[model samples]
Target: MKTAINTAVKTRTLPLAIADFKQITKAGLAFSVVFSSIAGYLLGADQIDLTVLLLLSVGGYFMVGASNAFNQVIEKDLDALMKRTRKRPVPSGRMSVPTALTIASVFTVLGVVTLYVVNPKTAMFGAISIFMYVCMYTPLKTRTPLAVFVGAFPGAIPFMLGWVAATNDFGIEPGTLFMIQFFWQFPHFWAIGWMLDDDYKRAGFKMLPTDKKDTATIIQIIMYTFWMILASVFPVTGLTGTLTLSVPAAVIVFILGLGMLLFAFKLYNNRSNRSARQLMLASVSYITLMQIVYVVDKFL
Candidate 1:
C-alpha cells in the first residue's frame, strides 16, 4: 500500500510540475521567439552547423524563459488581479517566488554560457535581451504606454541575435532583420493590448496607446501595420546586403501584408473585441508566414 501510494503521488506530481514549469516559462511564446531566431540563423548562415543550431535553440529558449520567469516574479501580485494571468504559476500559488527566481537565475547562467559557446557577441546580445525584458520592459509596463516601444527592443533582438550567432558580425543584414521585427511588434502587441484592455487595466498595465479603445488607438495600430508592411519589403530594396528578397517573394509578402492590413481595417470599422482578436491572429500569421517565405526564398 505504501509503494502504491508513492507511485500515485509521483504520477500526479510529475505532470503538475511540468505544467507549472510551462506556465512560468510561457512556453508557447518562447517557442515563437525561438522560431524567429532559427529563421534568422537560416538566412545568415552560409553553411549550417547542427551543433551551433542546437546551442542557439537551447540557449535562446533559456534566455526567454528566464525573462518570463523573472517577469512573473516581479508581477505576481498584479498578475493575480488580472483574469487572463490569474492562473499563472506564481499568481495561482502553484509555484513560489523563490523557486521562480532560482529557476530564472539558473536559466540566465545556462543561457549566457550556451550562447557564449556559440560566440562572445551572441552571449552579450542574449544577456542584453534578458536585461531589457526583465529590468526595463517589465517595470515600465505598469508605468507607461510607451512600454510597448521599449519592449520592442528586446523583442527584436532574437532575429538579429541569430544572425550574429551565425555570422558573428552585426551589420546592415542583421539591422534590417531587426527593423522588420521591431516594426512588426507594434501592430501585433497593440492588437493584443486592445483585446485585453480590460484585463490589462485591472493590473494597472498601460498597454494601449491612449489607455482606451478609441479611434486614436486604432488609427495608430493601422499606421504601425503600414510601417511593418514597409519594413517587410526592405530586403527587396537592394540595400539589406545578403538578405535579399526575390520579386515573387516580395509580391507574396506584400499580399500577406495586405491581408494583415485588411484585418486592421476591420478592427477600425468594428472596434469590437472580436475584430481585435482577428487582427491579433492575422498579425501572428503574417509574421510567421513572412519568415517562412523569407527563408524559403533564400534557399530556393
Candidate 2:
C-alpha cells in the first residue's frame, strides 16, 4: 500500500508540475514566438545556418516562456478572480509565488544567455521584450486601456527578434516585420477584448476600448486594421529594400489582407461575440498565413 501510494503521488505530482509549467509559460504565446522567430530567420538569412536556427528557436521559446511566467507571477491575484484564469497554477495554489518567481528568473537568464550566444543584439532585444512585457504592460492592464498599445510593443518584438538573430543587426527588414505585427495586434487584441469584455471587467482588467463599448473604440480597431493591411502589403511594393516580394506573392498577400479586413469590418458592424470571435480567428489565420507566404515567397 505504501509503495502504491507513493507511485500514485509521483504520477499526480509529475502531471501537476507539467501543468504548472504550461500555465506559467503560456504555451500558445511561446508557439507564436517560435513561429515568428522562424519566419524572421527565413527572411533575414542569406544562407540558412541550421545550428543558428536551432539556437534562435530555443532562445525565443525560453524568452517568451519567461515573459509569460513573470506575467503570471505579477497577475496571480488578478488571475484568481477571472473565470478564464482562475484555474491557472499560480492562481489555483498549485505553485507558490516564490517558486514561480524563481522559475521565471532562471528561464529569463537562460533565455538571454542562449540568445547572447547567437548574438548580442538578439539577446539585448529579447531581454528588452521581456522587461517591457512583464514590467510595463502587465501592470498597465489594470490602469488603462492604453496598456494594449504598450503591450503590443513587446508582443511584436518576437517577429523582429528573429531577424536580429539571423543578421545580428537591426534594420529596415526587422523594422518592417515589427510594424506589421505591431499594427496587427490592435485588431487582434481588441477583438479578444470585445469577446471577453464582460470577463475582463469582472477581473478589473481594462482590456476593452476605454472601458466601454463606444464608437471611438470600434473606429480605432478599424483604423489599426487598415494600417495592418497596408503594412502587410508594403513588402510586396519593393519599398522595404531587399525584402520585396514578387508580384504573384504580393497579390496573394493582398488577398489574405482583404480576407482579414472583411472579418474586421464584420466585427465592426456586428460587435457581437460571434463577430468578435470570427475576427479573432481571422486575425490569427492572417498572421500565420502571412508568415508562411512571406517565407515561401522569399524562397520562390
Best by lDDT: 1
Candidate 1 residue lDDT tens string, 1-300 = 999999999999999999999988889999999999999999999999999999999999999999999999999999999999999989899898999999999999999999999999999999999999999999999999999999999999998888999999999999988998998899899999999999999999999989889999999998988988898997898988888999999999999999999999999999999999999999899999999999999999
lDDT of 2: 0.89
Model 2: residues with Cα > 4 Å off, grouped in runs? none
lDDT of each: 0.94, 0.89
* Per-model TM against the reference: 0.99, 0.98
Looking at candidate 2, the ten consecutive residues that score lowest on lDDT are 208-217
Tens digits of per-residue lDDT for model 2, 141-171? 9999999999999899988888888899898
Residue 272, candidate 1: Cα error in Å is 0.4
Clashing residue pairs, backbone N/CA/C < 3 A, model 2: none
Model 2 TM: 0.98
* Candidate 1 residue 86 C-alpha distance from true site, Å: 1.1
